[model samples]
Structures are given as structure tokens and as C-alpha cells.
Target: MNIIISNASSDPIYTQIMNQIRQSILSGELQAGDSLPSIRQLAKDLQVSVITTKRAYEELEKEQLIDSVVGKGCFVSGANKDFIREQRMKRLEEKLLEVIQDSKELSMSQQDVIEHLTILFEEDQTS
Candidate 1:
């Protein structure tokens, strides 16, 4: 597993850590039962505090994305496909809402936004 931290981000260090790990699990880059680095090791690797890593792991555990075993460190949890799909859809919806707000602030019409989205969709398909 690889994690990158940015001092320029608005998010806290722990939140950045959590978001990266969450994305990895949701994208299947981290599979069920895959081991994660120990908290101390990850802290050393990231040059962050162990408390920050622990907080990220704890939050993931609350979301049932990972599980901790005594003396065994942490591992990704098996997920229901439906639940995972719902999670991804919700994230997309949140991003779409942000785009909609931005478009409205710029006085862009609905049709204009739709056209832009269509072009982006086609561009993605072609790529």
C-alpha cells in the first residue's frame, strides 16, 4: 500500500490518510483480508504521528472497511457489493452537487452544464 500526504491540503493529516485508504478499498486496490502496515510503521513511513494513523484506522473500523486483529495488525474487510456500489454512488452525488453549485454561481444554464457533462463523458469513453 502507498500513501501520500500533502501539507497544502485543507483536510487534516488524519483525514487525508483516511481518504486515501478509503479510496483504495472502494476501488479494489486493497482487497478483503489484505494486510495493512502497522500503525507505528505507517507513521514512520509517512513521517506523521502514530496517533494520526491510529485515528484513521479507527475511523475505517467504524465504517467496517477494515478490521484489527490482536497482534496481527489491520486488514481490509470483506464488503457487500451492493453496499460498495451505494457508497460510490453517494460520493459521486456529492461531487455532482458541488459542480451544480459552481455552475449556478457562474450563471451557467442547465443545458450548458448538461452539454459540458456530455462532452466529458464522451471524452472519457474515447480515452
Candidate 2:
């Protein structure tokens, strides 16, 4: 598992960790049954407080993205199809929101935004 912490981000350290891990799991980069580093070890590696990593792990568990075993460490859980679809849609909405904001900032018309999106979608399909 790979995680990068950004000191400059507005989000809390733990939230950053949790979001990356969650994204990895949802994207299939971290498969079901893959063991996660111990909280202490992850804290050390990330050079962050142990409490931060623990909190991230707890939230992940609550979201059902990871399961904690008594002696064994946390492992990625099998994702439900519906849950995965929901995650994908949420990510799409976030990206679309950003695109809309950028378009507005650029003073682009609605038709311009739609044309750009259509081109991008077709390009993605061809690739």
C-alpha cells in the first residue's frame, strides 16, 4: 500500500490518509484480503502521530472498506458492486463540480462546456 500525506492540504492528516486508502480500495489497486500496515508502523512510515493513523483506520472500518482482525492487521474488504458504483458516481460528481467551477471562472458558455465534455468523453472512449 502507498500513501502520501500533504502538509499543505486543508483536510486533516487522518482524513487525507483515509481518503487515499478508500480510493485505493475502490479503484481495485488494493484488492480484498490485502493486509494493511499496522497502525503504529504506518504512523512511523508517514511520520505522523499514531492517533492520526488509528483514527483513519477506525473510519475505514466504519465505512466497511477494511476489516480489523484480532491479531492480524486490517485487511481490505471485498467491495459490494452497489457500493463500488456509488463511489464511482460520487467521484464523477466531484470532478464534474470542479469542471463546472473552472468553466464559470473562464466565463465559458454552457454550450462550450458541453462541447468540451463531449469531446473529452469521446476521446476517453477511443483510448
Candidate 3:
């Protein structure tokens, strides 16, 4: 898996790592039981602190997206499809909440938000 870190991003390093890995899993690019790099190795490769990588792995574990085996490396969890779908829905809801908050702060109407979402969704489908 290719993980990119951006100093320009508002998100922290671990968050970026976690997001990329999560995207990979959700997109079926990373299969269940697929091995991930060791925490220390990934840190070295990414040129970040081992603590950062460990924290990312821990967060992923908490989300049930990956599992670590004693004396072995981490692997993608064999999570059920329903669980994965629920997780994805939760993420989408969180993002929508953020958008709603932003729109409210800008004094945008609900109808405007719905229209923007419809346009964006249709554009994505066409692409």
C-alpha cells in the first residue's frame, strides 16, 4: 500500500496514514488478511516517529479495520460486510455533519445544500 504524508494538510500525520489505509480497505484494494508493514518499519519508511505509526495502527485496530498478531505483523481484519458498511456509513454521516455545520455557519439554506449535493453526486456518477 502507498501512504502519503503531507505537511500541507490540515490533518495530522497519523490521520493521513489512517485515512489512506482505511480508503484502501473500503475500496477493496487491501484484502482481508493482507499483511501490513510493521509499525517500526512503516515509520522508518515514512520518515516519521514510530510512535506516530503505532498510534495510527492502534486507531485502526480500535475501528476493527485491522488486527495485530503477537510476534507477527498487522493484517487487515476479516470484518464482516455489514460491519464495514456500517463503518462507512458512520464516516459519511460525520462528513455530512461537518458540511451541514459549515453551511449553517455560512447561512446557506437546506435546499441549497441538497442541490449542491445532488449536483456533486451526479457529477461523480458520470465521471
Candidate 4:
């Protein structure tokens, strides 16, 4: 449970916490059944309000990324392969949307964007 909060970020503090935790789970850095710190402990460690940490945990639980156990603590939930694939696809769509917006701002044609993406993909494959 490593979390960094940035007051300067446009995202809310709770959102930042939630996103980082979600990313850790999605990336397999936090394995299934891994114990997470108690909400109070995490709040103390991050120096954020307990309410903020609670909200983040609630959201994660709602998303089925973690489960809360009475008197124990929050723990990472087992991953569902289908759900994970869907989440990854959603993330990819978000990133592509950002790229599309950037390309529009730069007056780049669709073909130009596709060419750049293709080149990047080739470079990545080669690397």
C-alpha cells in the first residue's frame, strides 16, 4: 500500500488514492488476498482524512477489486479474467480518446495519427 497524494492534482484526493490502488491490483503488484492496511492506518500514513480513505475503499469494494472483512481488514479480491480484460479495454479506450483529442488540437489527420501509432507499435515490438 504505497500511495502518494498530490494537492496540486486536478483529481480529488480520494480519486487519486483509488486510482493508485486499482492500478496496483490491475498490474498484479498487489496479488489476490493481499492484505491492505486498515482505513485508519492508511489515512494516518497518507496524512489524509479517514473519510477520504474510507471513500476510496468503498469505491474499490463496489468495483469488486477488494473485499472488507469484519475486524480483519481490506484485502485484494481474486481477479476475474473477463472483468480484467474489460477494464483493460476501457482504459485503452480512454487513452485513445485522449490521443484523438490531442490530434484534433494539432490539426493532425486520422491517417497521420494512424501512421504515427503504427510506427510506435513497430518500434515497441523491435525494442
Candidate 3 local distance difference test against the native? 0.95
Superposed by TM-score, candidate 4 places the C-alpha of residue 24 at a distance from the truth, in angstroms, of 0.8
lDDT of 1: 0.92
Query: 59-122, model 4: which lDDT tens digit per residue?
Result: 9998889999999999999869479769769979999999999999999999999999999999
TM-score of each: 0.69, 0.67, 0.80, 0.70
Sort by TM-score, best first: 3, 4, 1, 2
Model 2 error, position 32 (Å): 0.5
Q: Give lDDT: candidate 1, residue 55.
A: 99
What TM-score number comes out for model 2? 0.67
Off by over 4 Å in 1: 87-127
lDDT, candidate 2, equals: 0.91
- Backbone clashes (count) for model 4: 0
Sort all candidates by lDDT, best to worst: 3, 4, 1, 2
On lDDT, the stronger of 1 and 3 is 3
lDDT of 3 by residue, 48-99 (tens): 9999999999999999999999999999999985887798799999999999
How does residue 7 of candidate 4 score in lDDT? 90
Question: Given candidate 1, what's the lDDT at residue 118?
Answer: 99
Better of 3 and 4 by TM-score: 3
| Candidate 4, superposed: residue stretches over 4 Å from native | 88-127
Candidate with best TM-score? 3
